[model samples]
Target: METVEFYNGNKMPVVGLGTFRVENNDDCKEAVKHAIINGYRSIDTAMIYDNESKVGEGIAEGLAEAGIARNELFITSKLWLADYGRENVQAAYETSLKKLGLDYLDLYLMHWPGLDEAVMIDTWQGMEDLYKDDKVKNIGVSNFTVSHLEALLAQVSIKPVINQVEFHPYLVQDELRRYLEVQNIVAESWSPLMNAQILDDEVVKAVAEEVGKTPAQVIIRWNIENNVVVIPKSITPSRIDENLDVFNFSLTTAQIEKLNALNEDKRIGPNPDEFSGQ
Candidate 1:
């Protein structure tokens, strides 16, 4: 699997398994195990997802089945909006660790920058403390706008290593991407395939046909070509394997620009600035 290094020098696989709506415990567990068995080393989960225990089970099963040590896997979990206080954030991390059945996470992210800027700042300080205390390998934020990042950066003692957001051909987020680039922070894409909706886009379809690949593969490769981390979720074994098969072909600069021009700044998920703790 291809990898990228965090600001702290920790290596993370560029492509990971995203566990968002894999709600059934057994299904999520099996999906994670299958993903690991098929060579995936990175797994992304969150507190709000409420499947950390199942993910933990899958990790244990995958480790045993693959005969790989725990340290070889890059596991990530997020802190939810309700758990934004300094002390509450630590408790949230502990809860996730317990559910994940791990001593420390490879990456821990703030799920959202709540409406209150002060709360978000406090939550980040708590995350910084966790990193200093060796509870997590790297710290980051999700769904943060450029303005939010600028404010947070002004108050932070430790800069975030990443800013994960809804990224794809349609919602490219160029401004945020540029800011992250200047800050030396990596941009991670949560819905690289636009929840599988991009598979039918004319641009994606044409590129897939020209490249002799699936639309999913083309989209995933687009993220790779742009140096962005991608996590495409799937519980089906074949689809999981297909998502990981994006390393063979490369897109040309012109083709990449063609894909880049398809951006509309559209979003299928909730906006961070107005989220009300869902």
Candidate 2:
């Protein structure tokens, strides 16, 4: 799998396994192990996902089974809203580190903007401190809008290395993508498969047929071609293998244009502006 060059100079895999709904220890551990054995180099998890411990165990198992070094994998976790305060941020991050059983994290992020601008700044200071201390190699944000990023960037000494949000062909975030590119922050796609809705779309189907691949592969390839890191979550072994099969093909310019034309600005996640920073 290919990797993206992050602001911290670390290489993050372009494709990863997103353990969003892998709740139980058994399922989460096995799914992650299977993913690594099948050639995944990155695994994204968060406190909100509630499976960090299991994920850590799976990493251990995969490492022992595959005999890969620790630094060869890129692991990312996010700080939850409850831990957004200055006092709580550092402690919460430590807890996450302990749970993940890692010497250092590849990336750590503010899951959402804190309730107050001051706290957001404070929490980011803690993140900056962690980065300096070598606890985490990179610091970033998730679900942040352009204004939100601008707000934090204006106050903080260190800019975020990445901003992860919902991105797919139908929910193309052109303006935000352009802004982030200008800022030199990479955009990570949380739901790059369009919730499987586009798997049956006529345009995607046509593209899939032309490429001799499934619609999901077409979409994943599109995301990578767009320079966006993608993590498509699936517990099923077959689906997981299918999702990572995107590296074999490339999307055409006109086909990419057709996919771009399918944009409807749809978002499955909630709007951040109306969030009141909570």
**Best-performing candidate as measured by lDDT:** 1
Predicted candidate 2 versus true structure: per-residue lDDT over 92-193, tens digit per residue: 888988888877789898988745778778888888988887778899998888888988999888899899998987888999999999999999998787
**In candidate 2, how many clashes are counted?**
0
- The TM-score values for the models, in the order shown, are 0.98, 0.96
Q: Give per-residue CA lDDT, model 1, range 1-278, as digits (tens).
A: 78988777878899999999989489999999999999999999999999999999999999999999999999999999888888887899999999989999999999989899998999899999999998788999999999999999999899999999999999999999999999989999998889999999998899899999999999999999998999999999999999999988999998899999999989999898898586
Kindly report which residue stretches of model 1 are placed more than 4 angstroms away from their true locations once superposed: none
Residue 198 alpha-carbon offset, candidate 1, angstroms: 0.5
